[model samples]
Target: MRIVRSARAHIARYGEAPSFRELAAAVGLSSIATVSYHLRRLRELGVIVETRGRVSARCPHCGLTP
Candidate 1:
C-alpha cells in the first residue's frame, strides 16, 4: 500500500512513474518480483493498473482504490 502510494507520488512529481526496481528501492522491497507481488495486490484492489514495461497505467484520471 505504501509502495503504491509512493508510485502514485512519483507519477505526480514527474508526470511519470517508477519501474518495479525503482519502486522496490523506494519502498525498501527486495526485488522486482517482490514489487510485482505488491503491485498485483494493488491491481487486484483497483489501486493501480499493471502493464508491461515501466510506468504504464490506465486512467490515473480515476481514483486508485479498491
Candidate 2:
C-alpha cells in the first residue's frame, strides 16, 4: 500500500511520523478519512502503529505491540 510505504519513508527520513493530513498529501490522497482507512489496514497488517491518532511505521519482523 502506498500509504504504508510513504509513511515508512517519512518515518525513516524524519524519525517522526507524519500527521494524517500530511500523509494524505504525500500519497496524493485528498481525504484524511481515506488515509485513516489505510492506516487501519496497515495496523491490521502489522506494518505500522497508530495510538490515540498518532502514527508511526513498524517493521514486519519487529512488530509493534499496539
Candidate 3:
C-alpha cells in the first residue's frame, strides 16, 4: 500500500513515471528489488502498465511512471 501511494503521488507530482530507484526512495525502501517486487504486484493487480520501458498508471488507479 505504501508503494502504491508513493507511486501515485510521484506521478501526480511529476506528471511522469518514476524509476525503480526513485520509487524506492519515496517509499523508504532500501532495495530496488523490493520496489520491483511491488511493481510486479501492481502490474498483476492491474494498477499500472509498463510499455516500451516506461510505466504509466491505469485510469482510475494510482500508479508510478518509469
Best by lDDT: 2
Comparing 2 and 3 on lDDT, the stronger one: 2
Across residues 1-66, which tens digit of lDDT does each residue of candidate 1 receive?
578677777787767777888888888888788888777776777667765666434435566422
Whole-model Cα lDDT per candidate?
Answer: 0.70, 0.77, 0.72
Residue pairs that clash (backbone atoms under 3 angstroms), model 2? none
* TM-scores, all models, native as reference: 0.73, 0.78, 0.74
Give candidate 1's root-mean-square deviation (CA, Å).
Answer: 3.8
Error of 3 at 63 (Å): 10
lDDT at 66, model 1: 23
Model 2, poorest ten-residue lDDT window? 57-66
Question: In model 1, how large is the Cα lDDT of residue 58?
Answer: 40
Candidates 1 and 2: which is better by lDDT?
Answer: 2
Across 1-66, the per-residue lDDT of candidate 2 in tens digits comes to 677677777877877788898899999989989898888887888788786566787767755222
When sorted by TM-score, best at the front, the candidate numbers are 2, 3, 1
Candidate 3 residue-wise lDDT, 20-60, digit = tens: 78888888889988887878887898887766554565645
Off by over 4 Å in 2: 61-66
lDDT, candidate 3, residue 35? 80
